[model samples]
Target chain A: MPAVSMPIAMSELIVRLQQESPIPMDAELRCTGGQLLALVGPSGSGKTTLLRALAGLVQPRHGYISCSGETWFDSAAGHYLPARKRRVGYVPQHFALFPHLDVLHNVMSGMLHRAPETRVAAAHDLLERVNLAGLESRKPGQLSGGQQQRVAVARALAREPQVLLLDEPFSAVDHATRERLYGELAMLKQSLSMPLVMVTHDLREAMLLADEMCVLHRGRTLQTDKPLELVARPVSADVARLVGIRNIYHGEIAGHAPEHECTQLRFGSIVLKTPYRPELVPGSRVQWVIPSDGVVFHRRDRPSHTERENQLQGIVDTVHKLGEITRLAVRMEDEDRSLLWLDVPSHLARRNEIAEGVTATVSLTVAAIHIIDSTS
Target chain B: MDWQALRLSLLLAVATTVLLLPVGVFAGRWMAESNFRGKILLEAAIATPLVLPPTVIGYYLLVGMGAHSPVGVWFTELFGRSLVFSFSGLLIASVLVNLPFAIQPAQRAFESIPQDVRDAAQCCGMTFWRSLWAIDLPLAWPGVLTGLTLSFAHTLGEFGVVLMVGGAIPGETKTVSIAIYDQVQSLNFEGAGSMSLLLLLISLGLLVFANVLGRYAGRLHAYRNV
Candidate 1:
């Protein structure tokens, strides 16, 4: 064992989210043990608001936030610890690096009042960890935007906070830098043992970094699950849309049978099979979820065995090229105005001879088709 | 040369700066951070002595501080004498007359600091005064120094106020400007010329000092903004 012992393991965070506003709802979130929880939502979705409430920056009109039995904020008892005492590492959207201080001083700033002696060493270690070695003498203005952001991260970590809250940390950087920083952040979280909660509108970033994903809308949590589960089984049409599920069908359960039967999903003359359960009564409203990647594009017709599963015919409305993937917006001739979006690799798109305003058949395996009852 | 006037002027300028520097710092800080009603009005009122003719200020001071007035009587009771026609009276007038110059620069320096920087400092567990002294003051030093120099320069040029209130008593109430006026009145061009040349040099030196100090502060602020 090393001579220096680790700080005591901190408590999990508990946030009872409520507000006295035009719209009202009760939300209770418990993150037990040390675990990364990603709050994913669109803009104006109240993720930042929740982060602020947890940090005691903004007092929620009601509810409380407790971490490991330590009270940070409790409206009932009037116990609201200031932001400094809460010991949270909050990296705001703008990074908020002190313009006056150089990289070294910015990191050491959080340490000035407490443990002033170890401030320099701690700052240096964190900077080195973030791969900003020997850049301490440079002021924030002198560094590149990405380098400045890394310095801000180092400063936040210098305090050795128990929990870290990051608000769109990489949204300001370019794609290449954003990816590099994300890789560094992944390594940091593994070594630091601090649970991180990051808010990002970027679906791919959230999918890559989050351990548990939360889908929020209008200040409410619609679904909270694993990243894979969030994509596989979205709770609502909104959640499905948020996670980039391009093929969402508004269908009615047409058939139900005994053990392992099938529920016939009818959208526009096009019907698909979902695992049959007794609860899936005929004429009941249901939503089917299929990710854009799950839908395959092809030129030549395949065998009926594969075609019987989850295939639909549509006209290619538009082809939008985005980096490595080409997004094809295909219009289904079905009566249900459901649009199927197929994401094909740029190479595959070039090889398949797909073009805008052309006829194409996109297919999704039945196993890839996920059905959810509207009553949920 | 009328040395008495030169000595009084020097004494008045230095004493006024020393007396009002603390108040100016506080007021400047308040103006930078605090939000209050009629702030513009208060600023204008403080600057009235700078904008209004010195003779008008001198007339008001004369009437307000004379031995017969209530305030003058109370002041006399406290200090065993009145302020009128005294060197100490000139000191009070200089502090009042040059207050805006002292406060304006300091306020500007303080105001130039970004609010986010202060918020970040507060989040790092610093109290208001702790951050102000450690962070804000160092950043605002150039402005404070500029304010000091301006106040000193303005007070050194005091004439109408001292003549109206201090009554030009040799070795007691007379300042450099009053002495120069006395020399001119008595047709002593050589004495007046010597005094005028000295004042000119002093004014130039202070102005140059202020310009350099202000430039340094501006650069620091610009770097921070970047």
Candidate 2:
């Protein structure tokens, strides 16, 4: 038997889930011990199915799920453990707390094999840990949504499971309450040494909570990387859009600067510089993304650099004010009328007097530009 | 008053209700949750008693339980007793006639429970039987209780099926409905009137109790979702 603290690894988790209309799915994921892997996708993207497969709830058509050297499922071996036999703490979307059991009993119900006294003590201790100490006697029906979710988490943990699976656990709660729950979960994550997989459609929540993120689309994993890495270097245009990178354009390699190790890309009549890729030959067509935050707007009175390497002079096509940030659509002075999106702080937008029809000089930071092969 | 008839009827009703509790729950759950070929056919068969006239059911029971039939002959050889025109025969008739009443509402109750609750129970290391006891039964109790009460009440008022299968043996199979019919035929107006009033009150009371329980079940279901 492997120690409880070791990571749970699942390889080639191939499942064909039948829905009202069939959606293809082939998902693979990995989580190190004590790390949180957030599985994010749009609805019907097989995020929940993957979580269920890991918990031994959904039997995949082909796969092997192993944790600490224990085989939970293997197609070749014809070995599959049922959900009850798999030591997984699952917090479903609705929390699924037993309506008949009081909070303490709900937690204790998972510890059925423990001694009575020990179960009681541990249940109480867990309730306190979830900030639900005095509500132990309350039924799930009487508690608030957040409180009920807390009870669910505590109950799942009471099982002393080897892995924890949460499916949109915070989606039901109000935003204010969700923030607090996020704080509680972050603290809880520090103490738990088992692998945890959370399924969420909320990109912000996944970015905020997950140590690593696996972006799923149409039942397949597009990319798996640290949140920052995923946002910074999405593998494809679809992945770039999913990660909130809104500024993408078609460009071909114009030339290479060997001294600076950078490639110049021509987008219509405009040219830009990005880090060089060895795979790229001159004239190779590719898609490039510039993070919206990387497009900087210079003050109207500031002295403009005469160098035209990374700078573009364009007329602001539209302006949208969204609380703290202002989003602008800038149409480049090119034949294709290519538009670039830039997000500027509202304060900066006000100082620069940026608006629709205003000519603005925006610079795309070369270090922030990323390119992907068009074929991928 | 035909006290023997009343006693036998009550006994038959109680026994049928008790016997059908586990069967109803198990069948209800299976019907609600499982999907396989021929499920619709099985459901239609279970519901046949609800749509068919009581005499149709009584006629089948009578034929099936007669000593000439294979099942009846086997029972006679094994137990050394006839199944037809006996208290046991009436019990079987009542169970068949009231099965739909018990199963329909129970199936609805089981179906109403969210699937997530069942999944959560299994993920908590609960076996099928344990989840039924700890979660399904308690969450669906009011509806199940309503089913049981409806079955009991329907059995108490049983007439055609009991009359055909049990044939009005005074101390054995004669039930309240048959006794009242006998009294009315003999022009004993007062006796018939009293028995009629008693039956009316019991049926009315059970119906009211079931209604109250159904309302409570609705409230509980709403609470669970909250």
Candidate 3:
């Protein structure tokens, strides 16, 4: 029998799936009610599979999935709850609305658990809540991608579920629609009482909406923390790469400068200063990263204080404009071939006359430089 | 025109269509949904009627329904009669001979249904029967109708299986096709030619209906893709 009662003690979703067969995963995740937890990973990293497992759409060969104290799946005791029985609202990537049904019936279809008379009114109310009130009579195919995504969310909400799972729900929409949907999702998230787990490959998307993020790699959950921390302090070089840190490079501990409240590192052909780590022995090889936020573009017109430490002269390798910001890839003037990535406001690049094949100086914030374990 | 033969042929076609409705639906759906290792082999087996000669099917049906066969003996003990050369036997032969027409288009229709739509139906808390009725049937009804029309057209014109299983017994097994053959043999060229032309027009009409339904099913699948 499927577990129906929500335990009072089980207020949050806790999942642990570990096995080698069928979709292999060693993922464990937690999210309190009303919080949005983003499962961030690259493609084929088992992010969607993990979300499906949570929603009871995919069963792990071995695992325990519990939400609000109900044991939805426990492989040891051989307990399994099928997808429908679980109070989960899953919004698939494509927003698989019933094509034969109009938008109103599509939302009402998921309201089967509610009273018959209340369902229609409830569906109307949900459609209204999702800002789709006028489109209640339209079919899914007639709606725009953003509108379709809204209907999918409304349908999921009609279930009155304990947990909501969205699999890259806004990916199909245009960029402008995505920007609008992001704001709408942020608003909707504030009103949701259930925990929402969203799977996304874009860390920027996760950072924009998720309260906490769980970084996944090769089917294993690597780190779970606030999105900013995951970006600034990844636990290993492998995760640093996964989080899209492009400045990770080989370095060695030069020596500790206790009086300066920092430590020195031997970067390729140069010495750089970072936050003090007295525990590290000098001459030990290590991997380090500087957060993109820490990379400051130096200009002749303006003076900044922290630019004094780790000032490096590099040739701008490439410059690509992205709306208001210009993404710059700078190859440092050293034996190292790796390029450092920086995103500055578009006007900053134009004002500084920065472009490809031009020389530039940048400051790697001492406090933002992080050392990571070499082992995965 | 042998009106009794025509009437018997209409009865056989209608019976074949009605009887094969559920069989075609379930089998076609199974073929569409199943991914077992032997699925391809099973599909080929089900398609044998399309490629095999009607006489081969008729001969096998004759052998399997003879008194010495277990089915024949069991059927006789149950129904107090032999299995061959009767309207019931002809109906059975029609259904078997029309399997390909009744199943292939329907299977293609069911297969065209996006799997994610089925997943969404299940996720909506709809049971398997509910989804099949409310979702799968709605999406696949056009293809199913195509199968029925194709089967009806094919059943209206079947001759070899009818000849082998149900011999020319007027009002019992002698269908319009066999009646036309008998008319030609007796040198009644006018009667035979008129009946053949009428059958041709009816089959043409049904084929056109089936083609329209098939295209409608294709459009439904295309809409889902969009």
Candidate 4:
């Protein structure tokens, strides 16, 4: 009924929410100022809901959201701040610009609490930052998709919020516009000191823009780590798949080959040497993944010593040329549905004769074959 | 024409339009945005005046606000006068009868406002009232114009409900339509014809104005999607 205690003074944003019905989720997330955390999940995976919860739009059934020494929500204390009170900068999907207002007034709308005399100059300054200075008089309907997106960004930043939340902000734009916005956002990120959380389904976009990625699947946070780390060594198979890791396989922990400084894993009787995972005792079954970049296509013309390291011979089941790059799905002779996807330059693919039904061997480096401790 | 009745009709129509604007907006927005099992029942209740005969609604209003009824007694106690056959009583009856005309178009317009825009307004340090003024009202201005115009025109031409509830009081409740009926009964065909033609022309003018506002709003809506 009342708040008697003081809000905990902290620098980072701490959000742990539990909600039932309408996307039923349980998640705990943390992001410090100047850090960008990407929420990566498939549709219906509750990524948007989580972002809305952080914005104070969706009230969580339990837990608290604290940011920069202020408590935004705490279900335990029945202290839930309204969306407007949170002072969160949220750029919703499609940019959602006020259709009636011109670009300058739209940005000014976010500065309602500021003095009227100071608003015009500040709004103009924001428009300049967004590269929309000359387009101040233009309505949202008149501007291009990219310009509209910038207006949304300027409006969000006008409030000087403690946190910035972007819900698929670039989704409405064309490829060319999205690419431009990506660069703009990267530059904008340099000026922002608040915790910025972006929800994106694109793993590549997440990796490009975010300092950290939190992978969500079916309302649960499966993992949170640096983009490359999440891709290279996911904590679980679900996380491995969510991060777009293509070569996940089942294996058993064979004895550690300490003399060679590698751990041996039995992939259906084939002993694969991986970076030392000594904590996994012999005979423990595990799941592991390697990125497509790690899957090197061995060449018959020039055989190397490392080519023999964890080299598995397979017949190329599929060969797809993706622009200058070619993807070959190599099916191991002894396994089923176990396609090791290998990327090769188009000219190299031609020289190596990597095509469907052709026999090929690829090597997995000891460091690349990362064994996940949990599969759940 | 009975100019006193014509002036009274204009006064009543203006009051009704002003009174019902907020009511229409509230009901229209709620009906447009909310989804519930009871919503259909609420919608049907608001639509009663559209299907029922004017006298039937007028009869209910008369009874509901008669001297013995709770509302009638309460009004008499507060205002020191009988509720029936008064301007205030007539205004209530007109508002009730025009609910559908004022609310339906506004509801349709509010329904078309993109949900994302409303959510964005909430996150942009805006209170609900601020968003209503800056976002909802501007976006739905066309429908609101349509609602206000229709209700004002309808109130000017109201006859049976006004006759039943207000009983032809000069300079009080004797509206234009009732005046036209009176002229016809008194064998003043010329006066009746003049007033009828005038009502037709005013109604047409309002309708045309509404159409113009609608086109402007439509252009604005289209520009937003671009």
Candidate 5:
């Protein structure tokens, strides 16, 4: 039989949007199968609301959700299954560990009713897997925050769920601990073979863990695609800004020169080349996305011939050291009044001694110049 | 000194706390989670018994339990019993009067729990019963304990309600508090002094015990929320 004939049924999720404004608004959507997807948005963006709705905790005015093809909620059908029957594992941001139960008891609680005696040993195995082996007998109050979160993760997995929802799981942990947990989670996802949905505000985390990233704004999914693609080629300026693209330029397409195989953008006296197909006639509004890392710093006179894509004369207005990288805020003379932030590696920054008030030539490769779909 | 009275008092107190445990837990959960209109009014009403004179409650109970009343007739037919001047009547009165002692502390404890904890439990697909058993009950036990101790001790010291309903029936409804009052009324100095001392000591011991339990429970909640 073909793989399609023996296809494993995927979870069907749907949500309807309708709410008074200010924060995440109402929206409707349906997703199938257990896809490792990341819901990335800023604070108050409604990522948490979507997670809760899927979990059956927040019942919208109207929506339907089916897990693994099992109909759990249908407002039209008047079918509603409580969270317990939904059988989804939800790991909250705080990882609510039972205070009265020890680590072993906490993990075992998931399987308590179905398999009573197996819980103790299963808990031990899970604890050991999460790197809390000997600490199973210890109460949650005795454990550190990271350890408690690990215990919470172990508990959620004990149920052997098909779908797992994580809400900002690493937000509370230190950088080193978060890295370690992320590695653990990746390993767990491989073995679980389940759709793991995560809500995150951190761009790095979304990029690292998400198979597909959904960018939500005011409760609507603005863009959904592979993680790297969202950053390298955003759907719009809002998405580019959300993904931390610090350089955005507004200009008009001056002309399309077939000989150059590029479109010429006119901003004041400077002309920049964009690799995007010239889709409009001359004098159409357009925006350019240049990531901070794409902007290279060099003395106005010293430059490479290979970097002949987009060059602009700008003064280094400010410079600040940020860990392993140096951040430079450059002011370009454009009618749009946009500021460009360029990130230089610490070693390169030190060698070049880039500082404020230094006149520098900002060069961007045509490949790095991403054309954003204009709102208008 | 009056063994029958002493036994009656102890019986009423223990019975009241035992009866109110489930009620206290239910009320605590309700008040903690529910956000309805008149919620504060309901809470104030529940705590009214604690502040109002016990005699006023006793007077209402006496009127309601009168042989001609509807409640009295229902009780008569259903249980083949009349409540006035009976030991069971005192037990019922004590449980009703001291309910707030148990419920108020339990509610406060349940309220102290973070919403994140409840949301976490809900997210795990744990049903209402399972969440209550596995999370809410355990987390709120310290508060329950506080309510239990207070209700029991308060019930033991009740004189007004027991006097009005149970009366001074020897070997049946003559609780220690009532007996002490009777002794003082009759000028039985020795009997009054001895019974009063015992009641005072027992109540003092219980208060001390509750203080220790409260401290230990505080530590437990702190430990778990970590």
Candidate 6:
């Protein structure tokens, strides 16, 4: 009785695609039920292509896509379902609301097969859910950008699709409106139990709304991980940069301790420690990144009592005041003459009298030093 | 005043416009959305009527519909009459001369619709025909209307092709333009002047109405995008 009473379990989605035109797409992605996955990349990086392929708007020459136990596309089997039969709710970058249809009709347009009364009732209920309760008769052209987008979302949800795809859904609105929409989306995500995939070019947007982040570059999946993990331990320097990491240095493996599972890396004259991998042998070159938040800076006049494992003295090459934060570019006084970027609160910079010519003591915490494999 | 010639001309124009609507929409949407080999050649072929002299097209139609030709023989056997010098002959010639006017503007309208709009309609479970009816037709309505009006006006003024095929037969094949030409030949300047003025006023009104509608449609499209 308990087994029969359980809700229907949502099936996992798997997509592998390869194509060459309209911006080549070579990506493999997976998402489970109740999870929001963000596909992020630069412009022309095939993010939209991948989303379209999943929605069956664009077909790949070689691919296999299955969602909720349905084989939407399988090139090896020569099976392909058209977009009309895919049951996907896609909110394109421009929202793409029907201009001639009123808000209620736009929502009801997706429910054409249902009874007339049911479609009207469902559309009104959806409009209410999206906080557009009384504007049902207003056409999309008469509404503002945010209101139209809300109508678009309501229209998409009216069909009750198994998968929801949003392509840069909030990029069209102003920043203030985007923040409110983000909160609204977060609240909406709680009730929706389907797999949602959002394509975005903004790293902050991805970190704010997505449960997992997938970074793409040149039509290839660079890395996929939790937002924090992607920021801390990117698989490569390119991935680190794409995720907004500012501090990266070229280093070489100086020593490897098999007993302790740690590796010593040499960057110029500074020796850093990191969790070792079997592939990183001594004398091999590597690229490494240290998140700006992980770098501890102390005034040279009053040094802190923290451990000095990877301490270095450097001159502040430049100081950039960005709102409440100050970014300092430090030039190391070591043999490599490497430059390190650090972000400090503006109040702290003012209190410490940190200026472009000031000398500062910075420490690179061993646990935060991430060595990325260059082969990828 | 040759009211029968005026009525025949109006019938020919209306019939040609009504017949060209479906063909124009189909061809316009296809050319706007598709990329194929020899696309340029296909486009040029469709637009040849706009650039080539009307008499040249009339000559070809005359030869092609002559009794010796296959189409002429089939029509004669089927309808128990000759294919030349008839209202049907004038209608076909008018449609051929005005084909580009019906297609080019409609194609521009279809092309103006963003791909996202089509994709959004598809994602909503609308089939190709359903979307065309619900989204494409409505969004591109102004341009389609302009094309139809232009075709109607173009067919109303047709002289060379209709004269060649229909041969100016009074009450059966003669149209308003032929009537006006006949008046001019007989030194009846007053009749020719009145007919020409009527046509000028009608064509101007249709064009102005289409321009206003097209501008309104463009604004509507801009609002949707914004």
* lDDT (10s digit) by residue, model 2, range A187-275: 99999888888999999999899999999988788899999888888899999988778888788899888778888888888778888
- lDDT by residue for model 6 over A176-206, one digit each (tens)? 9999999999999888888899999999999
Writing each residue's lDDT as its tens digit, candidate 6 over B1-226 gives 7788889889998999998999789989998999999999988998998888888888999999888889899999999888889887777778877878888888989998999999999989998899999999998878888899999988888888888888899877899999999999999999999998888888898889888978977886787677
- Which candidate tops TM-score? 6
Q: Candidate 3 falls in which docking quality class?
A: medium
Off by over 4 Å in 5: A1-35, A112-114, A117-125, A305-308, A346-353, B67-69, B76-84, B119-125
What's every prediction's RMSD, in angstroms?
Answer: 5.4, 3.4, 2.9, 2.7, 3.7, 3.7
Interface quality of candidate 3 as DockQ: 0.73
Worst 10 residues of 4 chain A by lDDT: A1-10
Prediction-by-prediction clash tally: 3, 0, 0, 0, 5, 0
- Give one digit per residue, the lDDT tens place, for model 5 in B68-169: 789788888888888778877777888888878889889988887777678767655567888888899888887888889988888888888888888899
What's the candidate order when arranged by decreasing TM-score?
6, 4, 3, 2, 5, 1
Question: Is 1 or 4 the stronger prediction by lDDT?
Answer: 4
Q: TM-score per candidate, in order? A: 0.82, 0.93, 0.94, 0.94, 0.90, 0.94
Share of native interface contacts present in candidate 5: 0.67
Docking class of 4: medium
Give the per-residue lDDT of model 3 (tens digit) for A1-376.
1234333444588888887867679998888888999999889999988887887777889878888887889887899888888888889999988888999999999998999999889999999898899898898889999999999999888888889999998888899999999999999998887889999998889999999999998899999999998888899887898998888888899999898978889888888898888887888899999877789888958746563357888899999999999999999865676799999999999999997998888888887898775543
Off by over 4 Å in 3: A1-9, A279-281, A301-308, A318-326, A333-337, A345-347, A350-358, A374-376
| Model 2 spans with C-alpha error above 4 angstroms | A1-23, A303-309, A347-353, A374-376
User: What C-alpha lDDT does candidate 3 achieve relative to the native structure?
Assistant: 0.87
Q: Looking at model 5, give its docking quality level.
A: medium
Error of 6 at B25 (Å): 1.5
Residue pairs clashing, model 3? none
lDDT of 2 by residue, B1-226 (tens): 7888898889888999998898789888888999899988988998899889888888999999899999899989998999999888788778877878888899999998998898889888899989899999998878788999999888888888888899889989999999999999999989989988999999999999999999998988898898
> TM-score of chain B, candidate 4?
0.96
